[model samples]
Target: MLAVKLPSKETIKVVEEPIPIPAKGEVLIKMKASALCRSDLHRYHGKVLFDETEEEANITPGHEPCGVVEKLGEGVTKVKKGDRVAIYLGLGCGICPDCLRGDVMLCKDFQCIGFQKNGAHADYMTIPEENCLLLPEKMDFITGALSTDVGGTLYTACKRLNLNGTQTAVIIGCGPMGSGGILMAKGFGAKVIAIDLDNKRLELAKELGADYLINPKEEDVLVKIKGITHNTGCDGAIVTAGGSTPLNIALNAIKKRGSVALIAESNKAQIDPSNQFIRTLNTLMGCWYFNRSDWEEIANFIVNHNIQLNKISSDTFSISEAEKAFPLFDSGKTQKVVFTWD
Candidate 1:
């Protein structure tokens, strides 16, 4: 088997290794699809996104992944061989209240799959049988891989912001996550306002489902959003960019009682809470990954709405081409870059 490795900053290598065997209560998966993400870039650049003390850099860097089960470990009964599933990124102590409730990311001992363990950037991987999310029969491997990270996160954000047919959602930073936000918001019937400095990304956002596009470099983003809402602020905004400016724009572009979901990973940011949040009573939430319990609903929502999750991921590479995949994704030249088996 071959897997992706980020030995150092901006470096990616594919190395040959023996296929892993499943442990008790786990399942071995034959990799089919895995998607790259911005967070993966953070790790590829030699940054630790989570607590992995034992040389975390060597772990295979892929969390958005899906595949068919090849072998079931002892005590595993939830999934069987040949089951198509998307692996959840969070691994927590099952006894914890948060873990039992399916919010594995919130557990005190939470461990991210790609950051803390060997994830699905390889031809095969192993995971707990319970971590497998069954996919709809019609969904493709690429879309299934995406549904775990980009799709689920953005859809959860849309719901957190209370987006609906009557609301306008301003998605800052038109990358893969924002692109997913466009599709998810559209699924909820919300009018989407796509904001980004890159015109190409903005164009792609529009092609996805954005009702309006605003390039912050060309004009004032808050001004355009307000104007689009007819002097009223948008109903809500979701910021996928880590920059302070976009986060600030998201704070100011929404109505007084409006909500904002920050999905980006940032160490710090500058903001005006007194007026933009405190006085305005804005609802700001830091959303990470979706709850495991929500997987079925999220998958069903995608199928029921006919949301094209694949549109967000514009490129795919085989395991051997991981060297090329990371650089393209890091350059912001592509949306979700993925690895596929077949």
Candidate 2:
């Protein structure tokens, strides 16, 4: 089997290794497609941290994955050989209190698949059977791979906001996750506005049903959003960029007492507490991985063609071309890039 391994910062090496065998209650999958995400870039640049105690040689870095089950270990009965599935990246210890509450991402022993363990950038990978979600018969590998991250993250953000039909929503950044938020908000019957510096991404947001698109570099984002909402401002804003600008924009654009759902990966930021307090902002929520219910909902929505995963996915690379995918994504020339084994 061949896998892309990050031996160190800014280094990716392709190496041949023996295919892994599934342990008890696990499944072995032959990967079909996996996506390169901005988070992967963070890991590549050494912006994202990993446990130093863990063996770095064992680390594999592609997490947004879809594959076919090749075998199942003992006690695994939910899926069988040949099942098409999307592997959940968060590998939570099932015995934790948080896991018991169905919030596996919050588990004390939580470890993400691509970050802490060997992931799907390989021809074959192994995962606990419970982490795999069965894909619909017609779901293609590319779409399924995107659902593992882009679609799932958007779903989780929307879930955090508890969006209802009457709310007005704005999404900052218009990358794959931000664009996904536009579709998710629209599906929930909210008036959606998308903000991005890139005209191409802003145009794509319009195609995905954003009622308005704001280019912050050209227009005053807060003013435009306020004007669109009849000066009331958006009921909620999802900040999908980690930079200080998008966070401030989201804070300024949201309605008083509204929520700000942040899905962007950030380490630190300069924030104004006074402004947040004056607005009586209900909360600033951080949404990362999806729960089991969120996974099921997103899968069903994609299967029914409600939220079009196929349209959001823009580029494809083979496993050998993984290096090129990151640069293309960083250039903002593509929306979502998937690497395939076939």
Candidate 3:
């Protein structure tokens, strides 16, 4: 088997290794497609996003992966050999309240694949049987991989906002996350307002079905959003841009009692609660990733709505090209970069 190893910051190597066998209650997935995420860059830069450790360089770094179950381990029944599935990144200690409810990402002992363990940037990887999310029959491997993070998070975020046809959703970033939001929110029949300082990202957002585009670099985002909503504030806002400014704009762009879901990775942010949400009776939620329970619905929604997940992918590379892939993705020159099998 071939695997990607980040020996150090900004270093990538494709190494040959013995194919791993699934352990009890686990399954071995034959890699088909894997998507690179911004978080993966932390590892690329020799930084750890979780517990401190010197073992930061060996773990493979592709989280969003879709593949076929080529083998099943002892006692595995959640999925059988040959099942088409996408890997759920979180490996939780089952029986906890959070894990029982399928919100494994929130488990107190959450071990994220690709970070804490070997991931799918290889020809094969092993995962607990329960983590296998069966893909919709008609869905492609690329789209299935995307449904894990980009699609699932966006769908869960929009659902949290209770978006619908009568409302407007202001997406405060036009990167892959925000672009995915355009697809999901539009599928829910809501009007979309795409905001980004980058014109290219905004244009991509528009192509993905944004009803309106606003470049905060050129105009007052609040003023433009007000105009689009006819002086009334938007019904909801999803902030994917990591910063206090974008968060504040999203908060103030919504109508009284409206909602905001923060999906970006921001450690600190400054905001006036009284003006942003306290007095307005607004709702704010920190949405991480989708619940394991939502995987079926998320996959179904993508298939049933004909969501174009690949439209957001700017590049694709084979695992052998990891050296080339990481640099380009780290450069922030692409929306989504994927690794695919022949």
Root-mean-square deviation (CA) per prediction: 1.1, 1.8, 0.9
- Candidate with the larger lDDT of 1 and 2: 1
Candidate 3 regions off by >4 Å? none
Report the lDDT tens digits of candidate 2 across residue range 58-164.
Answer: 48888899999999898899999999999888777788877877678788788878888888888999999988989977788888888877888787788678787
The regions of model 2 sitting more than 4 angstroms off are: 52-54, 278-281
lDDT values for all models: 0.90, 0.83, 0.91
The runs of at least 3 residues in candidate 1 whose Cα sits more than 4 Å from the true structure, single-residue gaps closed, are none
lDDT of 3 at 180: 94
Task: Please give me the total number of clashing residue pairs in predicted model 3.
Answer: 0
Candidate 1 vs candidate 3: the lDDT winner is 3
**How many clashing pairs per prediction, in order?**
0, 0, 0
lDDT digits (tens) for residues 169-189 of candidate 3: 999988889899999999999
Candidate 2, residue 13: lDDT: 78
Give the candidates in order of lDDT, highest first: 3, 1, 2
Give lDDT tens digits, candidate 1, residues 1-342: 998888888888899999999999999999999998888888878777786665877889889999999999999988889999999999999998999999999999988888888998999999989899999999999999999899999989998888999999899988888889999999999999998889999889889978999987789887787789998898999999987888899999999898999998888999988999889989889999899999999999999999999988789889999988888888888988988887
In candidate 2, list every pair of residues with a backbone clash: none
